[model samples]
Target: MDLDLKCKTPILSYSDDEFKQILEIRGKTLEQLPEDVNIIKEWLKMQPHLPMHPTDRQIVCFLIMNKFSIERTKEKIDANYTIKGLMPELFSKSPLHPDVQKTISLVSCGFMPKLNKKLNRVYVCRLESTDVVLLDGYNYFCSFLEMKTICDFSDSDEYIFDFSYFPMKMVTKFNPMDFKRVLTLVEKVYSNRIAGLHYVNIPSYAEAMINLIISFLKPKIRERVRIHKSLETLGEFFEKDQIPKEFGGTGISLSEICDNMNVLSKEYDEYIKESNNARVDESLRPTKLINDDFLGYHGNFKKLQVD
Candidate 1:
């Protein structure tokens, strides 16, 4: 597998020193990987009839997530396509309907425009309203995948979940299956991208909500989850200027960030549309579907203790 380093846009920007640090962690150099373009070419050679050629940045994301292990990267690439094919509702096409957009907007999630000194991007989410009925899990998941496309530049990501205004009623509305599906994709397909997850102003009763979500993560990732009693505590992990004003930081407000993401999401519309066609043909695949396949899991939501 050849690496294609030529990205049309800066997916993740790193200084020369930071780039070296990343390579050292992976035990490889840019020269060894070259450009990730070759990696996509090799994948095409193997599959021969994939619906679309993944962008170089997307290929780099798989490579970085897999620690530059060619074999592991190949497996993730295949699984990525396979999952997208299986879960078109979440992976293919952006949701542009007015109602769908309104539902997603109500979720109050957006990526911060700034990166930390380490260059890890920050994702901020909050529930500004108590109308849980207004939130659509499928649309939320789709928006997440859309946001994930722009997060490819950095190998690590930091998440801040602000639950200051979280409604207790919203807890029961949580869809465990949708939650599990998102984690499944993150763990199986977008592995090793999350560096840290911080929960701020968490209500005491919301511990159950956190526990339910954490149960889906691996041990290492579970360990990365932190609950903070105050914004000051979160400030220890990130600079004040790096944080958004909505969170008591000096940066722009969450509303502004969401507005910017709205524009950026539109730009990804075509890519998402094309992604719908990138499904895997099961008959042509060398492996048979198993219970552990992307969409194989099925059970009662009651089993997840959502009630």
Candidate 2:
């Protein structure tokens, strides 16, 4: 490892047990990973559009995300950096724009630690604010995931969006275009494997809003969504302590959970700062990469995605 790569603080943190567990999840172990890293590093040197010398830890995570398929891993690395110029909204870094902070206050959100036995990390979001029609949904969702990504690296990501506190009067205030953009970022760029998406406390009045959001998702992702009339069904998927107390689970209140998340916010400030400087230089790319399956529908991806 280069001295600089070794000296830098690791961006992704997990316990020793998790380190072993994640490898086991994919039929891999620590023994052979170094060889894999070296192989990819040689490949990286030939690609001028990306950083040739990221740390071993960074390569391992990207390998895990792509299940160590060499070709897929290369594509994901390209898409990951290609993302910034393609959709900068999702990269909105911290000391967040004032509008992002405002959007956050309106929604109580957190990526909860207590995952199901399925190893699915749940991103819990609730529209906790009132009749205010939000104009900053894009910034809010983008900002939320940016901070959450550093700590939450489960094999599969799940979501529970509580629509109870929301009012029907502001339905039209939502731009499904934000939903479209968010879907694009998560599927085509982040490459986070989504296990499922759950919508709870959705009254009949709020059904259309959920439907509209679902419409923008690709079929594969849309098929993973489930709508619940109330919170009653959550117990089947999560333990009592994993679900929030307000919903009759023993877990702490949503506000408290989100407040605890602030501790991670500062931990991430420097990471996001460093990442913001790592954009892809298309002129250095070896070949033109027009939009394709892995690139999603981003019209700008002609300069992105490897294959």
- Per-candidate alpha-carbon RMSD to the true structure: 4.3, 4.4
lDDT of 2: 0.66
lDDT assessment of candidate 1: 0.66
**What is each predicted model's overall lDDT from 0 to 1?**
0.66, 0.66
The window of 10 residues in a row where model 1 has the poorest summed lDDT is 298-307
Estimate the TM-score of every prediction.
Answer: 0.82, 0.83
lDDT of 1 at 16: 57
Q: How many backbone clashes does candidate 2 have?
A: 0
